[model samples]
Target: MSPKEENNIRVLVTGGDGQLGKCIKVLEKDYPTLNLSFTSSKDLDITNKKNIAEFFKNNSLDYVINCAAYTNVEQAEKEPDKAYLVNAEGVKKLAEICKKYDATLIHISTDYVFDGYKNTPYIEEDVPNPINEYGKSKLKGEQYIQDILGEHFIIRTSWLYSQFGKNFYKTILQKSTTEEKLTITTSETGTPTNANDLAKFIINIIKSASSKYGIYNYSNLGESTWYSFAYEIVRISDKLDTRNLEKADNYFTLAERPTYSVLNKEKTLKTFPTSIENWKNSLSKLQNKMYDE
Candidate 1:
C-alpha cells in the first residue's frame, strides 16, 4: 500500500496485547505511513457497551479489527456466561458501534465452530455444529456481527501461535523441559497459523477491504495434531528434558477436538495469495523469534 493509502487506515485493533493483536502492533512499523491505533483488552473492555460506543463516536476509524474474545476452551465449559459476555455480547457491541460509525468490522473467529466431524477441510458454508462452549460462544459473536453489520469480515483461524504472546508454542516449549513424559492428543488435528501472517493479510484486506468483506478461512496450509506439534518443539529446542525423548507418549484431551478442522483457502486466495508455510515450518521458526526477545 502507498503512503497516502496507508495513512487512510485509521485502524484500531482491540485485544492489542494478545498473540494476534501484538503481531498486528509489530506490523505497524512496516505500515508506518498508516494512521494507526491500538487498544488492548485493558484499554477498551468490549463487554462494556458504552465504552465501545463512545470510542467509535470520537475516532475517525476506517476499520476495526476485533481480536478480543474470551478464549479459554476447556475453561469456557465451566464459565459459559463469561465466555458469552465477551465473545458474543462484547462482539455485538463492536459490530453495532462500527455500523453506526461507518467503519468496517474485521472480526476474528475460530475453526472450533465446527464439531471436527467433517472428513475434509472445512469451508465457509459448512453447517456449524459447535460441540464446546468456546466454539459456540465465538459463533454467537460471528452471528451478531453478520446479523447487525452490513460490511464485516469474519476470519476463522485455528491452532494459532505467535512469538509475542502466550500460545501453544510457548506452553509446549516450557513443559517439554519439565515433564518426564508429555501426553498430547494425537487424534485431534488442525492447521497452525502464524500471527504475523494473519496481521499482514488483515492489512492487505483493509487497504481494499470493500471487496474482502465476508467470511474467510486463513491459516498455514497444512494440518497436524497437538502431539506432533509438541514433538517438533522438542526437536527444535534442545533445552527439552532428556527423560521424555526416548519414546513418544501421547493421549486424548478432555475437551473433544475437531479431528479435521483444517480450513479451506479458496476465499482468501482470491485476494492475497495463501501462505505456503506448513504446520512445522512455522512452529520451528517461531521458537527462535520468541527466544530473541
Candidate 2:
C-alpha cells in the first residue's frame, strides 16, 4: 500500500487548557494528517476583535475547534455580561474571522439550550428555549455561528468531564475522598460525556473530510442523575467510607438546570460513524486511567 496521503489539515483549538482541548491534544499523535495549533484564552482572546485579527494574520488555519466557553452556570447568573461577552460575542467574532479566512469552524455548545420540559431526547432540530443565563448565552453563540457561516459544525453536548479539568468527575472524586457522606441532587438529569470520547469524534470528522456541516448532538449513550454519577465514581474508586444520597431540594442551586436534557446522537453517529461508549463503560475506562496514574 502506498503511504497515506497527508491532507495537512491544519486545526486551531481554542481553549487549549480546557478539558476537551486537552483530550484532543492527547489524541493528536493518532491523526498524522492533522496539524493542530492550540491556543488558550490568554494566547488568543476571542472577545477582542483586534486580538483575533492579529492572531489570524500571523497564522493560517483550515479548521477551528472552539471549546472556549463561560461554563459556570451559577456564576453566569451573577455575571451575565461576562457570559455573553465570552459565549455569544466572542463566538460571533470567531465566526466572522473564520469567514474572512475561509476556515471551517467546529464549535462546542451545550444541551442546556433546552428548557427540560420535553420528556424525550433533544434533537438537532429542536427549538431552543433556554431558561438560564448560561444557556441563553450559548444559544446566542450557536445562532451567531449559524447566521455567520455555513461551513460550521455546532456540536451540542452534555455534562462534559475529564481528568484534565475541574469537572463533575474530578469534583466527585475529590469529594468522595474527603467527605464522609455526599448528598447530590437527583432532580437534574443529563448524559455525562467523557471529553476524550467527544474529542475522538471531532478528530474522526476531520479525518473523514466530511462536509456535513450543521448542528449535531453528541454525548455518552446513556443518561443519569448527578447523584448516580457521584455514586458510580465513589464505587469505582473503591471508597468504602463514602456514602452517596440522591436528594431533591427546591433551592439546591442558584441556577436552574434541565431535569432531563439527553441529546439525541443519531445524526452524529450516521454522519461520522465514530464508536460511542456507554457512560458507565467510559467511566470504567477513566477509572483505569486513574489507576495507572
Candidate 3:
C-alpha cells in the first residue's frame, strides 16, 4: 500500500443524523486521508454495550466522535433517568469500548456544565456546578470519559446551530416569515456557535494527530443574548421589520439555565492555532449558506 493509504485514519461518528454530525459530513470530502463512517442511533446505539462491542469487533476504528446526546434541556428535567442513561451510562460504555480497542475518543460536551454564575467566560479548569438536569447529565458523561479513558478530547461548546438540523437559527428564520411579532428573552447570555466551524476544528485535531488529551472550550469569539441572536438572524434574512422582533426581560422555561455561560477559547486557540470567527460573522455565513442550499 502507498504511504498515504497506510496513514489513513478511520473515524466513526455516532448520532450521525444530528446537526453537528451532519455538519461534519459536509466536510468529509475535504479530508481525503480520513476514512469516515456515520451512524445514527438506530444503527449504533451507544446505550447498548453489546451492540457497540459487536460493531467494534467488526470494525477497526482509530477515533470515535460522539455526537449522540440527549440535548433537550426542558425534557431532561422531567426524564433525568433517560438523560443519565444516554449521556452518562451510554458514554461510559462508549469510552470503555474505545479504550478496549485502543482508539482515541473525541467527545462533544456542553457549556451547560458550568452554572453561568461567573461574570467572565468559563475556562476548562473551572469547577463545574451544573444548575439543571441536562447540565448534570452531560457533566457526568464528561467525568466518565476522563476516568475511563487515557486518550480523549472533551470539547465543550454552546448554543450550537447549523443548516442541517432544527436549531435557533432555523427557528428565527421560520418565525420571521410567519410571526408578526417575536419577543425573545435577554436574560441569558452565551455564544452562538456554528457547527460547521466546530466540525472543521474536530477534523483538524484528527488530521494533526495531536495527543493533547484533555478538555477544551470552543465557541465563536463573542457572546450575545437570545434576543440579540434572534435580531441578528432576522436582520440577516432581511425580515427584521416584518417580524417585529422585540426583546423581553424574561422568558419561561422548564429548565433553569445559566444566566451567562460564554466559554473561553484561549486554550483551544493557543493549542490548535486556528482562526475562530466572531458569532455575528459566522451567523451570516450560515444564513448565506442556507439560502444558497
Candidate 4:
C-alpha cells in the first residue's frame, strides 16, 4: 500500500442518522487517521441513481459503508414498491458506484431473510427463504451486491437495537415508563445487538482484517424472544412502567414474523477474537451511555 492508501483512507458512510451509522460516527473520533465523510439521506439520496453516480464521481473513497435500508417490516407489505426501490434498487446503485470507484462496500442485512423455521442459530451460509416483502427485498439487495461487486462484505445481523434512532431500547424504555401494561410476542427469538458494539466490530474488520470481503453473521452474545427481551429491558431500566404487561399472541394481525433468527458468530470470533457483549449486559451499558448523554 502506498502512503495515500496507508496514511489517510477516505471513507464514505451512508445513512448517517441510523443506529449503526450514528454509532460509527461516535467511534470514528478514535480513528482520526482516516478521512471520513458521513451523510444522511438529506445530503445524498441513495434511491436516485444520478445523485449516487455524481457522488462517486466526485469523491475518492477507499471504503463505503451502507447503513441505509427500508426497515419497516409490516409497512413493507403495504408499500412493496418503496421497499424494493430502496432495499433492492438502492443497494444495486450503491454497489455499482463502489465498483466504478474500486471501493470496498460494507452492506448491512437482516436475519428476516430466513423463513424462521429453524431452531438453531443461522450461519452466513444458510439459504435465505424470506416470507415477507421486506425480507425478500433485502435478500435481493444482498444478491445484487454479490453479483455486481466482488470486493464487498455482506454482514447479516439480527434483532439490531441501538440507543439512537427508533430501536427496541428507546421504544420499550419509553413505553415501559408510561404504559400500565405491555404485551409482546414470545415467538420471535434472536440476539439483541448493540449498535455501538457492532460499529466497533466493523471498524476492527476494516483495520485488522485483510480482504475481509465475504458474508458474515454478527450480533450480541446470547438469544431471547421479543417478549423476554422487553421484560429484561424494563427490569434493567427500573423506571419501567410495570402496570401493563399483556401477552399478544395474535399472529393473525398481518405479518407473521420468523420464530427464530439468532445468527451464528463463529466466523467473526475465529477470525478476530471479538468480544461481543451479552444482550442484557450490552443493553444496560447502552442505556447508561445514553443517560449520561
Each prediction's TM-score versus the true structure: 0.91, 0.95, 0.96, 0.94
- Residues 1-293, model 4: lDDT tens digits: 12236658888989988888888998777988778889999888999989988888888788888999889988999999999999999999999988887889999999899998999988888899998999999999999999999988898888888767897778888877677777887767888888888888888777763686789988998999888788788776656644465666653536667888899999878877578878888888876775222
Tens-digit lDDT string for candidate 2 (1-293): 12223577788999998989999999988888898999999999999999998888888788899999899999999999999999999999999998998888999999999999998999999999998999999999999999999999999999998888799899888876777667788888899999998998898878887888999999999999887787787787766343454455443778888888999998888888687899999998988894222
What are the clash counts of all predictions, listed in order? 1, 0, 0, 8
Of 1 and 4, the candidate ahead on lDDT is 4
Model 3: residues >4 Å from true position, as ranges? 1-6, 240-243, 290-293
State each model's CA lDDT, in order: 0.81, 0.88, 0.91, 0.84
Q: Whole-model lDDT, candidate 3?
A: 0.91
Comparing 3 and 4 on lDDT, the stronger one: 3
lDDT of 4: 0.84
Q: What is the Cα-based TM-score of model 1?
A: 0.91
lDDT of predicted model 1: 0.81
Q: Comparing candidate 1 with candidate 2, which one achieves the higher TM-score?
A: 2
What ordering of candidates by lDDT runs from best to worst?
A: 3, 2, 4, 1
